[model samples]
Target: MKNEINIIIITPELSKEGGGGIAIYTQILAKELSLDFEVERVVTLKERAVVNRVRVLFLSIVKVFYLLNRKKRKIAHIHTAHDSSFFRKSIFVRLCKIFKTPVILHLHSPSFALSFKKKSEKQQENIRKVFKLADKVIVLSKREKEWYLDNIEKRPPLVVYNGMNDLISSSDKVSERRNTVLFLGQLGHRKGTYDLIKAFKKVLENYSDAKLTLAGDGEVDECQKLVKSLQMDNSVEFLGWIGLEKKRELLNSSKIFVLPSHQEAFPLTILEAMSTRLPIISTFVGGIPEAIENNISGLLINAGDIEALSRNILKLLNNTLLCDKIGEFARERYLTHFKLTQTTENIKKIYTELL
Candidate 1:
């Protein structure tokens, strides 16, 4: 076998507690990157038990020193987001620069652009400096790339859509799923759970059998209260952070998949929904539009528009032919453009080109 290309990845969270989008993305990405590159990953976020800030700082300095001291040539792949995350990863970025190591800042935050605006001019300059130091900057979608250009004067950032495995084949394109509209993400305002609830209220007027299953963690208590207040307890179900098998089971069983999130950076769950051949109803925010063609592969609506959301939900639920057509087209789109293999290959190419 060819001796692999050496690369070191530093991420804030590696364990399950830290298992947000970045954790899932890192696990799959490192695995794929390892096929052609020798990857050394560093998880900065400590376990449940932690000491004071001084101790954390000392430990971080020591870890960076150790990683930079390695004899082999490797790109420092820094995964960063907003606020404290930027500060922490900035340390690694500066260290890589000090050691003359090539750096690639893989930005994966939807709130990153907004956060940049919150910072002072000096702080924003420092953030831009961090971007400039990188040998290459990777953003999630075309929208994100534009945002970066607008904020930071640097080389055009690269766009890489997050990818997942496709579940349904062309032959298995038909969806026999129940009249359930599934929302698979964290439960909160940013995810549009409240709007989904309101929209489902409208949906109930037409098809009383329609069910909305939200399968993730976040603000669940508040969500429970909202459901009770709205008197939708029976129709809305919160599975509370399900495992992969349970998620797949729900995706397979559900007829419609809806993610009304007001913010995103090319969500992997939407791709997961597309893979399962579920007709999608998501907001037009972020890079979701890049993956979904409005009324073609999936229906896109304005964020917080409960009426429009419910209208699409009702449309798909009533028309079996339209639902199946969209679902089949979505799966076909996934196979054509958004497979995990394609993502891995594109990433591999980027690495080779950079070298």
Candidate 2:
């Protein structure tokens, strides 16, 4: 029997074509919650072009207003990022308030605190007002929750770590994987793509047969130029904007996963790597330290420290026993703390409380 409760999830596009972690999280939440609750997903920001986006956003607001006009009690779960995304979702939050419907603002921006500080004081006040209107606010990490409490709002936001289903299967074995280091995200300075390329040049000095695969879109030509300048054309391969199957294949085939991002809020890529039991090498920023205990589950270094990044890559490459141990621990951590079911249950509890 289906539950009587209704959940309307408003987010950006859910398709893999142009979606990121926010879209993936929204998809997972909708899928898992649909089994019990009456879940509906509304796509707001799908177009890349600005004029098109404005048109779509207006239509979405109209549609949501219609949906909320009904007499039934409903909840609005709005997923948003920084800058334009925040403003876009704020409209829906206001609509919820007009209808007296409960609204849950789920923030997904990795550098929200930094970006919020950079905004003008008036804009910052507007953001704070939006948060105050929401019935509840959900952050991706404890660090983010504290930032929101101190800066955005006086009320404490709930910290629900982004979670996903395990990608590795019983047949997959780490010993059978290749000597490949994989990076999955936008190929730009923010994700430290150039730094990873520079560090990989150092890794090639020790392991000539090792490979580096970069999978994602953004600044591809620039990254390729850097790779070529370092004389690493043969060692580095760029796969632009891959889908789920290709991501799974790369995770399964690769020996290590590296995402030396300058900023992050519990990246889904790290969780993806952890679930596959590939020892991770990432920078200590945002909520990374919470998930990855240094030298235990995975390795962590300060952002932009190319020497340390290279050293950690070599450390995992040289010691097979240590790599397996860290990978095993990472999998255990994922199962215990970051499972999709756990996130769904926590979210359900919040919904129950609000209803």
Candidate 3:
């Protein structure tokens, strides 16, 4: 065996709690990759790739020269960049070319452009330029790849569905009497936090005991205000930013997992809920459909459709057998496709080929 592939994982952030799914992916993937590769993670402290508030270009240039000066470095991978300054991109691209190293551009965002809003001309041009520089573009889902394929004239992307580490140890511990519907993920417009509240309000007509406990954080005050406005303050529990222990705790007690996201690239949260045998009710967006087979593993409703979201939630709540059946199916699907080991093997293949 070739002893180790010296690989560097460069990203803007690496905080476990603050960085969301990307950080989780980096942490887990790096640990797994360490088996075959000597992985070095270099994260910028701020949004700008800075070293003590200095530009990343300066330090990246220093790092690249150091690597090139030393021998046996196999790959220099850059993870997730958005709307970077021209100097950073030029310096990075030029350095990679000079060193003759493969640069893997891993894209975490569902959209190709930096801002989800209407893109400025400069932003559009810069995005295209960045795409051109990458040797390989690793997209998290097929839906995300579609945007780049249609818009950018660059090397096409590879779709690698986000993997889930088998952290749900208490799979047998089922909630016998579940009264709560759990929403675990970013609480924002794109995530459909508003729609979930509206649907939960509608659900209260018949299943008055049904309570919504939100896990994770984003626009927390706004989401809480909406719940209060709907007089769901009594019905909803805003458990903001639960840790791993608390996340598992919430998942165990909850009847159903709901994510009414308008845009998603693949959610690890859904897989986690599934592993714990909670039936899912999600919007038919992104890789969610790739995983959820619309009432098979879970129910998939149209994004922002409050009525359909409520209907699906109510269906699972009313039929205990249906909930159990769907939960079983969801767990089986996760085992088959989304397991950490399986995903790691697939990623290893990609790295091997690239190297």
Candidate 4:
């Protein structure tokens, strides 16, 4: 085995300050990879930091050229979207082929073919061509990996579930709890913020003492309006955006954790909640089933089923025994599979094997 492996991870959009799942995943994974490899991150701030198109294009070109000429024997691992066409085939992909080094495209989203097919046939064909260029593809969920293997021939992907760092200790577990529900993540339709609000309305019917706390920000006006229109001001609380300390505080104090997202590859918040011994009630989408067992570790309801969502929320709140069991089971699951130590070891092995 080589003494060290040099790897470069390039992403179009990377924010060190924003509250995005991809950013957090990249941060943690990068830190872990650094323990065993010489990992350098090259990020392009597309619209957030750059205003001039020429400057943005020039910066991307410089970054690529720097990676291409930096060393001869290092791997250029790129984080790219599936449909990032000519840019991928001619720029990043072509560079790897030129250097005679393997390229790993770690994908976070679903196939562009599937998403583009909903838009137009021509768009789908364009996306299909882009998929044919990747040397090795990485997906976060089994569903996503299977989708690629089933649709695309000769370019199968490796499935690796996103991992979260363990932030809680044995002493962090609390015996006392209040009647509070925590929802962390974007306040948008696909995240199921609206669905959670609707379910919270029904949940409040029986559990009048319960309060709902909403964290993270997106489409703020719409979510705020929905809460006001439902006359749930007294029961609902919104904290626009919070840091690590406040997030942990909310998770620790809350009685139940809920995430009703319609689409997700994997959620870092779910693992965070489980790490703190919080019972999760989430929608059955993406790799959620891999984390939560229906009615075992937690409850999993349909994406848009408000009635079932409300029912489960109420069930967990009313029955303290069920809540304790689920929360305990969730924490155990986190310790058993999602802990960062094992995740880092597995990832380190993959890097060494590639080297």
Q: Which candidate is the best by TM-score?
A: 2
State the C-alpha lDDT per candidate. Answer: 0.83, 0.90, 0.76, 0.75
lDDT of 2 by residue, 1-355 (tens): 8787778899998334848888888988899999998887888988788887988898899889888987767899999999989989999999999999999999998878888989999999999999999999999888888888889878899999888888885545566679999999988998999999999999999999999999998899999999999999999999999988899889988999999999888899999899999999998899999989888999999999999999999988898888889999999999999999999999999998898
Candidate 3: tens digits of C-alpha lDDT, residues 143-186 = 77777787776467888877887656565533374779999887
TM-scores for every predicted model: 0.93, 0.97, 0.88, 0.89
Candidate 1, residues 118-233, lDDT tens digits: the string is: 99999999989888988889899998999899899758988888888765533444346688989988889999988998888889888888888988888899988988998888
Residue 96 displacement (Å), model 4: 2.7
- How many clashes does each candidate structure show, in the order listed? 0, 0, 0, 0
The pairs that clash in candidate 1 are none
Better candidate by lDDT, 1 or 4: 1
The positional error of residue 134 in candidate 3, measured at the CA in angstroms, is 2.0
Tell me the spans in candidate 2 whose CA falls farther than 4 Å from its real position: 14-18
lDDT of 4 by residue, 70-112 (tens): 7545676666554442244336666666677667777765334
Better of 2 and 3 by lDDT: 2
List the candidates ranked by lDDT, beginning with the highest: 2, 1, 3, 4
Summed over model 1, clashes come to 0
Worst 10 residues of 4 by lDDT: 81-90
TM-score of model 2 (CA atoms): 0.97
